[model samples]
Target: MYYIGIDLGTSAVKLLLVDEEGSITSTVSKSYAVEYPRPGWSQQNPADWWEAVTAGARELMAGVDTAQVRAIGTGGQMHGLVALDAAGEVIRPCILWNDGRTEEEVCFLNETIGRERLSGLAGNIAFAGFTAPKLLWMRKHEPDNFARIAHIMLPKDYLTFRLTGEFATDYSDASGTLLLDVEHRCWSAEMLEICGVSEAQMPRLMDGAEAVGTLSAAAAQELGLPAGTVVAAGAGDNAAAAVGCGAVAAGSCNISLGTSGTIFIPSDGFRVDAHNALHSFDYVEGRYHLMGCILSAASCSGWFVGDVLKAEDFDAEEAASDPAVATVDLPYFLPYLMGERSPHNDTAARGAFVGMRADTSRAQMVRAVREGVAFAIRDCVEVARGEDIRIERSTLCGGGSKSALMRQTLANVLNIELDLPETEQGPGYGAAMLAMVAAGDAPSVEACVGRIVRMRGSVVPDPQAVAAYEERYQIWRQMYPALKPIYRQMAR
Candidate 1:
């Protein structure tokens, strides 16, 4: 009994092979290309994803016994649009989660369609990167292709379909599509009508750990795995990462800082914000979670160090930031490098350093990068607080979490203890755990997490620093709304 998890990411498909005991036996990754036809647009060929997965699977199990493989699960980037025609032909390259080409469609949904109505129907409002807006964008801009669509899919769902020969998706993935009634755990016909689509175009939905179907013959042969390997209904990348970090229980939180950053607060009952800011999505545990995401996080640091400063060694660059080490706050920073999402759904927004002076040092600039991400995340935490959710502590995992300075910054900024997981394998680990549960190797997702995942250590917030960030966070929330109209105009 073994399981393989495929993490279909923005740039690559990461394949992980794990035994029944949660030990990782093999790990492989294959990168793919993303095309940008326009400045704000991002797309990837479904063929590219399939090729990477097939190649990665072969590499991951080359020396292992493929016969022992029991199940396959996925954790993938959310809200990317993948379309196929009646004959199952790839209609076009998928629009990615970071694609901002659907601003017009997003405006029409949030303004004309009304956020309240959209939230009522789907438990969340539309964002430019959501699959539904991408659908509308296709309908408006690529009418010929839209006319031929027989099946609509998300990024990872494309992989699942190729593996299982089943046109199905999980609730967590569907929730980000702006087409699902997340509370009801089903497609919203009203939302479909609103988007000028129908239920026929959607896939059958399931919880993340449920078995969708067995692997197809072609897929099994390509990957050198058993033909009957169970393909579980996998989750969207964030949800998968949450489960990977064992953030499935009520009141548990996991912060992800990839190209985008998110604060995922897991809960048992369903809840939506009055402003429709945070998303209420179905969790892998058959429960619900509230999430808030910002489009740019660590990428801001990369940009500052690589592009702005023309420096490559980020660690060396960060180590120079003495101002952030003890008791001083950077005077200015706004890390909206690629617009923004969550509390501020402004695609027109741009990044800036507002209060810089002649005295601003390279270290201070670096510290600003660290502090800006923290302040932005705290914005989402405030929204969660307004909902009466209390987060005394949180689990941290991500590239950003690797920075001791950043971890300390986040811990204090949020005024909470940040715990690191024992098996912090990110999304792939969680997906493999889900596959184990579906394969009957584990009793449940919760049980498997309790058994396999452990807390390594904790980063505690300093009361003094928390007080400093509280003052800065209060100021950070003001800058966005004041900058909103400017962002809108710039988008035009």
Candidate 2:
């Protein structure tokens, strides 16, 4: 049997065709645009996502035996709010996950509503990127649109609705909404009330590997797949990627450096951090995980290289970078381009180059960008460490992980062994595994991953690099606190 997995990413829809044996047969990607209407706001059209997924699926299954396909699953960007009207039409362009337009709402929830109260209701406290804050932002600024919202879902669930005509979401994805009582794997009544949204507006919650519904006839025809193919309730991108990396067992760790960076630590049971610095969310394994998210990761380097420098080749830039200069304390970068999330929940924070000199070369800046991301991720690692979770090794995946410098930098900065997966297709590969479980080809997520996921190699931290990064990381930590006042002032 064949399974189709769709990764509804921030910038593209990646479709994968996998056979029962766990090998990716074919893959296709379709890109879309993210709109930045204002300095800090990010949004995207839901129609564009639908068009991309359908087009990519057709291309993915071209000349293949469509009848052999059994199930379809999706893993997508989490926490983006997608509202629909009564007629099931998109209410507006989706308020994207990286959007920082909810500072007021976030402050209202974390301060006015009280962090303790919010944390008790939802496993997490309010962040600007969370769905509840977005809802509050809409209610106050765009009341007409808020009133028109008959349905509320995350980015990937929007695709699930398009494929199966089902208003449903998986636990891992729902966990990010700040409307879910993540401990119970259900929507929180108090959170719903706080957001001024009805429970009816929420999607039905399911396990990541469970079937939401079968593909609708129209959707099947559009994608050139069988009408009755099962549609699995997929996971959030990070959760799905962890599963793909075989990080299903308790205490397992996975680090991702996609648009955002995250240190995902799976737990066998629910465990919320004392300060709520890290996100406590449901894992794809039907348990829990602690995640520390960095708002900017690979995107930081992409922006600096592609936009600012007007250069397309990242490898060429990295090749010329002086590794020796990276050890010095003069030049440092804060990867808060879209504001920070984990460790520091400051939305007013902006990216800055703290120290530079006349002789500072573009190569040195490139090295700074890469090392800056590594240092930011280490911030989250420290949080997990505070919770008494010792992470000695972790599986790594994502666009940034493809960089030898990044992988080694992360290993050295965090001082952890980094395992490289054989097939690092990210969430799409795990979404396909979820499809296998939904179709009864696999017993569970654990079993599916056990059979499919394999470690191809590992990157061990260099002792000298680790020592140098330890010093630099301490200095990097001081930069954020020192700039907090300035960041707030600049926001005005």
Candidate 3:
């Protein structure tokens, strides 16, 4: 039997074909453009996603036995608002997770509605990227479109609807919407009223590993797949990635350094931090997890190298940096290129190169970018530590984890061992694991994860380097607070 995992990302839809034994046999990726209609307003047509998925699935199953494919699961970018009218046509371009146009709505929710009340109702504070604020934005700015909304779903959920003709979403993905009472694993009526939405607008909730529906005949024909293939309720990208890294059990931690960075800590019971810095949400495994996200992680390094330096060879540039410079007093690069999320929910926050000297070299700047991201991750780890969550080590995955220097930098910066997973496909792979559970190929998520997820090696922190990074991190921590007022003023 075979299972397919579709990761509907911001830039692309990645499909992974995995067998019952947990080995990936084939993969396909289809890219799409993200529309920026205005500054800080990111959107994408839902039709574009369907187009990519159909094209990618055909390519992924070209030589494979279509009859053998049993189940399909998806993992996608979270908090995107995909609204549909009563006839099921998309109301407008989806407001993407990275969009910052909900600033006014976020302020209204966090300040006017009250942070304490919001947190109590939804298990999280309002951030500009969450779904509720975006809904409120539409209600205020695009009331005509908002009024026509009959169904609301996340990005991946929309794809599932297209495939199975089911309007449903998994708990893990819905947790980021600020409309779910995450602890109860259901929609919050209070939050729904506040967003001026009804419960009927929300998708039916399911566990990530549960089968939402079978593939429709139309969808099967479009993708050249077998009809009646099981479609599992998929997870948000981070939760799905956690399952990929075998972070389903309590006390398990996973750090992803993709376009964004996240420190995910799984717990058997739900717990919210007093500061509300970390997000308490339902995990893909039906428990709970705390996630701390940095808006820009590897993307910051990408911008520095590709845009600023006009360099394409990232490995070579990263290799050029001297390891001995770990002890040197270097400039700090705030990795808030797209503002910050966790701990500091400041959308006005901007990236900066502080303490740069005339003598600083390109390699030093590169090192700074890496160190800055690592430090920002450390800030998140500190919040988890404050909650008494002991993270001695964590499973590391994502594009940034491929860099040995970055692995070492993160290990030292966090002063913890970082384990590299054998299959670092992240969300796509995790979605496949969920498919396994839904298809009865695996008894449970934990059992499936244990059998599939393998650790390759560990990156241990150097004592001296950890001490050096500690001092540098303390200095870097102060830079954000010092520049906070400046960023707000500049925004004005």
Task: Please tell me which predicted candidate would have the highest lDDT against the true structure.
Answer: 3
* lDDT (C-alpha) at residue 158 in model 1: 89
Clashes of each: 0, 0, 0
How good is model 1 by TM-score? 0.97
Q: Estimate each model's TM-score.
A: 0.97, 0.99, 0.99
Model 3 poorest 10 in a row by lDDT: 322-331
Model 1: per-residue Cα lDDT at residue 62: 87
Clash pairs for candidate 3: none
Whole-model lDDT per candidate: 0.87, 0.92, 0.92
Question: What would the TM-score be for candidate 2 when compared with the true structure?
Answer: 0.99
Off by over 4 Å in 1: 324-329
| lDDT string, candidate 1, 1-492, tens digits | 678988898878899988887888889989989898988778999999999998888888887788888999999999999999888789999999999988889989999999888988999998888999998989898999999999998888888889987889999999999999989888999989977888998899888998999998989998778898998998999899898898899978999887789999998889998788888888876799999999888888888988889998888888788443344345668888777888888787888776677887888888888888888898899999998899998888877788888888999889899999876667898899889888888889999988888788999998888887787777767887888888777776
lDDT of 2 by residue, 1-492 (tens): 899989999999899999998899999999999999998999999999999988898889889999999999899999999999999999989999989999999999999999999889988999999999999999999999999999999999999999999999999989999999999888999999989999999999999999999999999999888999999999999999998889999978999999999989999899899899999999775689999999999999999999999998889998787474246655888999999999899999888887899988898888888889999999999988988899999999999999988888889999999999999897999999999999999999998888878899999998988898898888889999999999899999
Clashing pairs in 1: none
Residue 386's C-alpha lDDT in candidate 3? Answer: 92
Q: Which window of ten consecutive residues has the lowest lDDT sum in model 1?
A: 322-331
